[model samples]
Target: MSVVNNLVDIRALAALVPDGAKLVVAKDESGVAMAATRELVRRGVRNLHLVTVPVSGLQADVLIGAGCVATVESSGITLSEFGTGPCFTRAIKAGSIRMKDATCPAIYAGLQAAQKGLPFMPLRGIIGSDLLKHRDDWRVIDNPFGTDDKIVAIAAIGPDVALFHAPLADRFGNVFIGRQRELMLLAHASRKTLVTVEQVVEGNLLDDDARSGATIPALYIEAIAHAPKGMWPLGYGDAYPIDAAWMRAYVQMARTAEGFESVVAQWLAGDGALKPLVGAGLGELAGAAA
Candidate 1:
């Protein structure tokens, strides 16, 4: 609805989010994704809701300090067979957030229900799991159809705002997501979407099908910001990889509220190691975190 293409500071973006707003973050190796979450927490946003196809190590740490509730949309089979990191488990232990295991389809179904202005969607798979017990946000209702089990009345998730970082975008707010469709889904589901891009391309340059293959139309976007390496801690696909050391440090710092505040102070003071990458664009700052 509102499209802005400028190199706005992360703090300015953070200011746009209000306290107690429900935030849905994309847990990926993208600088924008990670930075968005950091900004939200710094801005005093509580009641955060983190959404990821499969939550990442870095995202788990951010969630812990933000006091966010994590909604994971990936099969437990994978995480159980090949263990997920201790991020979520540790957060639960610390009483920082709650965790729910579900599929991306469930997230989509819930979001779609919201976008369609529906009250809720009946889901079959989450019937008797601990997911039901913890999701006080969703209402569980009887199917009343025949012999099937009760369904989870997944409420629509209409977030007040959504922030993301991408490879490129135009001044008019058209985004190029490259090969990551999961991130695109996040942008689409939110009520108002904000994006930070590595660079601003000419609007017409995106006409080519090859370059525009992963583009999200400008109509749904509200603003476009040029912030490189905005997804720090998280990788930006081939553009840059995750900085494991930085992620580890973030994990250590977020273990306590005071430590989390210290990290935020460094971020605001422009003393963060990740600050320089914000200028070089996504690829320039990729993997630059210490």
Candidate 2:
């Protein structure tokens, strides 16, 4: 199969994201695209209106800490077991960024509405919750078919770009996402979708029946880069393990106001200063195997 023109280097992939763009990324477990995220911070992309599919961790916090984000819309942001996202905490307390509190179902419904080019998607999960009061876009409406049933309609979320990392991508731009189906929704709903993958396989991914069902067609992809271990610090769908200690160190070092900036700078410099030095679990196993 002949490769399309969508294949590019990591820097070029990151360059496709504009400053102040409405950027959408997936959850921590669902391909965070950390390599390109670091590149974004390096390039000083600012005022991003970030939407995490449901929740997030490192990638979102790093962007918020680096001042690359102006607003965040998500159900929640945390470091999993490590604790709260210190940078996100500071931002919220300082009132530096706008917040759009949301539920997972509402976010999905909104994206689905955008995918189908609809004005809004109806949701029953947040009908009587306080979130309806805070979110103007989420409206309460009585069911036209029924007498008194009430459901909230979520406004369409038409993002400028959607980006994520994946395990395998073909030279033809077909991204293999396995069981992560929301990635497809993200691609279909957003204006442009960019991908970074652990490997770019030969020939056509759609040629095989086993691979075709899980692959996102190239029509929905704007570009893809070959980024091995792209989800470092976070795991890659059983391909690797999450570096919990590295994340713990990040949380520890980034406790102070200036500490967040120092952590990012050191990590970007690739000085081995933040390379998960706990000598246990994930990093230890990796070292022993190496």
Candidate 3:
């Protein structure tokens, strides 16, 4: 199928994400859109309701530290091996952003409910958990067809936009998610889906038999940008490993507000800001993510 060439620059992709929008992001392993996220910070986007599919890492910490988010709904937010997400921790302690606690299954169920156009999705794992008590939206309901069986009804979660990074996108706009199925669901449950990729290939991904199974159709994608290393500092599938040195640096610098500001300033000043696209044409058009 033909498409309108959803290819855009990182800045344009960030422009599509506005203030006060409900934005959902993927987990680190699912291809985090760090580069695009930096652009959002550069534009000074504000009041975003950020939802992390299950959980998140540096991206969440960065956005929270930047004051771009007003609320965050996620199972948890941590830097994983790098330790606590200092900015996210600070935000919660200061009550700067509303935090809605959730479980991974509950989050998936909520999105699934939204995908199916349902008001709520019944889940069992969260029924006896503290998250259910903390989340009033999650209700304990009696099983309709069983006796005395109770379940937690998770409210549907649909975002204004779903943003992520991926390995590749063809000139036709199809993205190669390649086993990260949650991205498909994220796209399905969101009003729009934006993608940044490590490279732009010459042909449609869907037309290739081996890659077709893991590709997301262009119809579900609003726009895509060619951004090599878009997921830098974090790994992208099996293509690369997390940049351990950078992770350590971020963890140390993000400990204080002042240090964090310096980090952002340096990043925006081109330490990590996007440079010009390299090469040209379908066979060679690829550039650093940011």
Candidate 4:
């Protein structure tokens, strides 16, 4: 495909996400692609295996509330200062979705194993915790070298698609995640990396020595969508700050099925309530990163 083809609209981006796919999302509070996520909901995408890198906030909660998710594999899902995610809490309470609870480090290790093309990754913690009891894919292996010590091994996480938002990306598709280096592992671990960014730069990001360490080259990015201020309700550096009041309102609306629908309806229909979150509007979204 031509470099221009990589940039696509939000609807196109959402359509690129196959139903029932194993979708791994970015980390908590940072790099959460809420703009693309809203598009996914609008498109009615469903049965997703939503894996949060570690912890999650609005992205996971909104997807769960929209019924776009079938299973959630994560360390935990909360709205941070907003407290527990109402929709996630409701789903767990109702047994509406399968849960693969994990620790923050374990999730990171799983992704790391996949990035390294390993079958599994060994971890040190969660040795005596109940978290291990529920996970069949984890095993306790004795130290074969000496001293008879045991460590936990977790299966590698190889997602069909990895998604996140960033501050900027170059026209050549190099994504600048800045200090959020875990995104590099996320892209490496997944079969495809879909990105949405605040803006697109003109030159090649890899050519800049200062940003080389913080950039995920075009080779790892499969698609790009323009989503200025896309990370709304979830801050991304100084470009924006979390919309605490909106989050609180969402928490209230998500408390019940009907209330949640009210929020979804407003969001999907471009109601004024959510206009601030849409940033540059859908028309300006989806551009070739390469």
**Leading candidate by TM-score:** 2
lDDT of residue 13 for candidate 1: 68
lDDT of each: 0.59, 0.87, 0.86, 0.83
In model 3, what lDDT does residue 261 have? 69
* Structural similarity to truth (TM-score) of each candidate: 0.71, 0.93, 0.91, 0.91
Candidate 2's residue-wise lDDT over 135-204, tens digit each?
A: 9899999988999898888999999999999889987889999888899999999999999999988889
Which has the better lDDT: candidate 1, or candidate 4? 4
- lDDT comparing candidate 2 with the true structure: 0.87
Per-residue lDDT over 220-265 for candidate 3, one digit per residue giving the tens place of the 0 to 100 score: 8999998888887787667888877778877887888866766676
Measured with C-alpha atoms, the lDDT of residue 239 in candidate 1 is: 70
Q: Weakest 10 consecutive residues, lDDT, candidate 4?
A: 281-290
Worst lDDT 10-window in candidate 1: 73-82
Better structure of 3 and 4 per lDDT: 3
